[model samples]
Target: MNTQHEFKFLQYPRKNFVRNNWSNLNGRWRFLFDDEEVYTHPSQISQWPLEIEVPFAPECPASGIGDTGFHNRCWYQRTFQYSKNSKRVLLHFGAVDYQAKVWLNSHFLGSHEGGHTPFCFDITDILSESGEQILSVCADDDPLDLTKPRGKQDWQKDPHSIWYPRTTGIWQTVWFEEVSEIHIAKIRLAPQLERWEVGCEVFVEGPCFNGLQLKIKLSCEGKVLANDTYEVVHKEVHRRIALSDPGIDDYRNELLWSPEKPTLIQVHLELWKGETLLDSVYSYTALRSVAFSGDRFLLNGRPYYLRMVLDQGYWPETFLTPPNSEALRHDIELVKAAGFNGVRKHQKIEDPDFFYWADHLGLVVWEEMPSAYRFTHDSVERIVKEWAEVIDRDLGHPSIILWVPFNESWGVPDLAEKESHQHCVQALYHLTKTFDPTRPCIGNDGWESTATDLLGIHDYDDQPERLIKKYGSNHNIADILTRYRPGGRVLTVEGYPHGGQPIMITEFGGIAFVDRKGSDTWGYSAVQSSRELRNKYEKLMEAIHRIEIFCGFCYTQFTDTFQEANGLFRADRTPKFSLNSMARATRGAGYSRGELTSTPQPPPLPAPDTEI
Candidate 1:
């Protein structure tokens, strides 16, 4: 990763040009800790401790302060000096787990709330003329609060199964880059290969970019199609241009980006004042699409099954953030070793490096919105605001295919019946689609299914015959599952039943093999031995390993959390189940001598659409 050229990392394959070139701002930074004053304003920040790497969360091993305590909030301070010729200095944060406040050289920049979304601030005016300028940030996260999106975080001080320690502070890269004040802030690029069209919207921030000539181009296989210089006098510009012949079929060798291909097209942007180039920036883009037909999801317009694993994105050594880019690569390698086509990133939006690796490794992501606490008028507003930001900020990535907002109704229980809550969920889904129509949104995962694109639910039983009986002809959801469940679901079934149109176990196979002989864990049930759990799990795996009706299934998880032991890997990134065994069971390569009901059992099956 270090030897890769700078342009190679910052580019995204849009139509002919790349999106904003601000993503590659990564490097070393200073460190400090304060309650409030130090972060609210950089000037009030007093002397502090040593320097640390930016982007790497303090909890991560690569970060200088690894394995730190969370009782107190953390403060990050950094100083940077840029040349006067620099057009603009923008500070970008890939993510912070909770709430964060930013200040530039004593000037208040901005404050944001939300743990898994990215935020940025324009600091062109706050930089010094010649020397170092201090950058301070304060982060506060209370995992036990249950008011925010703290997914599977241990309620206790120490971590255990099913729940990991919260990444309480800055967990992603933080850096600043210089751009023209009125330069391109963000670009939403959509490639329609079927229609030979490329739609784009440019978000502007300054004067020079308002009315200048913005030249756009589309290219592939080292060949350019269209290049036009348009005028944009406002802060935002929307444009859609038709490519001569969407090289989709005409091009000899296609750049169909996938984990295997991972081909990228270079995109260059230039702001020209007549013949003079006012600003020149480099980026890249990929040509891909994700959609859904009936209950089956489609990628590149073709049906694709999601052979995935539950990606909790946690490491005992790093908590939420990986130690470095290499650590990010290591996680991807682990997923590939498991023989999964993708990862269902449960509740957390990981660092950019994680997404980068997913893009390179060709991993599809079921990007779920982090689950939050109970929702009221105020809390719902906060969650919605964060959702919008996350959607917009991450639209450039090709890895994300589905957006899941509500998981088992953790924060919201009665949204399907409430007009306002239902409206919020529907509105966010619509907004997400309007921003990036490339992918289909799951709307909400499990339980309450309303006017959503897909009907997703969870169950624990493995009786495929039972699923065919209940959903096949039944007409109501009331008889399927009970509300008493922590995460409600349809009638329990283990196999991937075919009668249930686009059915997915969604949640099951959490066969934990961890033994906590002397430790107390916060679980609804008492601790069980790894041998006992794995035995039960192998039965479940044997049931679904070859029954290929369901779209896909995500096991309880990839790693152990606080008290939830249904993870393939232990809490410390060590595999509990042999990787070789996992590879065989996951890729439809294993079979058990279980009964395959040729005749119907007394019990029933499941259904989609109406219910039953």
Candidate 2:
């Protein structure tokens, strides 16, 4: 394939289960709004009045129909040529907002809910005998419904305080892949840094066969580290593969993964049944560990201070969907250029491409679930279900260091008083830990925390002196948690007192610079010029660095998202101030203990044994 086509296919919905051959069904598609809910099936829609760009919501300018008005329901139809062959076809949707029902050739395929996670269907049987196949989708998203996870989407007519435009339907990639009758369905790689081993779990689908085997290969820099094969007795197989330990710190550090040095261990897997290859996939992972030591966050068994920026993953043209794959990489580059070692993906499960780049470019990510406003049975169920899928989809990425299930008591609004709300928070926290115990899980990020591994405070006070005074020492922190409440919300729930977990200001410093004239924008604090912004930012950094108790800090945001113009860069990604100035302010003289340094380049590795 040519470079453009290759790039298109490389935008695979899932990074872990990637295949070389696949079709990109993105470009233009027939579209229409179904506000009246008249069409229940694709056959009922008589005419297609509009065309929309796939993966971009109708509310976004890139979708061609940039109507930001309230339209709860919409329809999409597209046809692709597919010749029936020996292989089975699987259709995948990266994500659809709220709820989605799909049909192929007017045949009812299936339905999926939860806006942030991916869902797929086996479309082999539903394909038309002819070369062309018709695929239709009906997305029903209630704009006013607060019971579903909406992320930063506003339900109102226009963009509001913090929420931007709504992403209605097909906000992520849509494509299909051809696979054999039996293939690898899923794979999960868990890094056990302490033991110098990696736990591999593979799930296979199709008919049960006696001679099915899975071949696994691990390599780094063209040197083979491990090559093993296992007989598949059942659908799921788990094994721990040990790596040769380089006892010296210098040699071992090269194998470990950090934001400064992202050394990925390339993985190759092939499913075989009696010498016939059923499936083949290529993936990568790294060795890393995230933990807490008293008031410090430990990475690779050492105290590593986190300087993270809040990224909403929004663009001027595309609301939630990135315009292109390169945009995702560019965003990470921008974050690193600003001197932030990590990013808190605030209130949204970002596209897999974002995580892919983060893993490759060596940037830490805090994956957070979007919030549902109302706390109800349905809301709880929806958040829990989607959150699991979120974890399941992106669990293998080495860049992710933390899992944030709730933010600032969103969804569970009465968490401070209601016992049920507190239970819900605890439940979600435990659920996240149960799903993936490798990383630390934050129950409620901002305030009113319960059953949390970390205590995250979201104090947007722009005053640096007040911040220092609030979190200067252990006594001040304890006092603020018990007596003084930031944002009029208690730091922890009534029963769940501060448990001495590492504390960090997960949200702060939302200083808005009005780059666009008369744009009706706002932030926690506004500045008139770049100099003023720089002065205020530098002071805040200085204050944060002086705070001996804080383990880390996440600045308000990375880009100006809609009306909430509290970003280092504008919506177009142009920096508000000079990049060097921003980086200097972000890094600030140095940490009290020591200065942060880039990962040293690894020396040449010794030769490894040839694979059998």
Which candidate number has the best lDDT? 2
Judge candidate 1 at residue 388 and give its lDDT.
80
Q: For candidate 2, list the clashing residue pairs, or say none.
A: none
True lDDT of residue 189, candidate 2: 92
Q: Write the per-residue lDDT of candidate 2 for residues 212-324, one digit (tens) a residue.
A: 99999988877888999999988777999999999999999988889888888888888888868888887788899999889999999999999999999999999899988
What local distance difference test score does each model get?
A: 0.62, 0.87
- Root-mean-square deviation of Cα positions for candidate 2 versus the true structure, in angstroms: 3.2
Query: Largest TM-score belongs to which candidate?
Result: 2
**Model 1 worst lDDT run, 10 consecutive residues:** 603-612
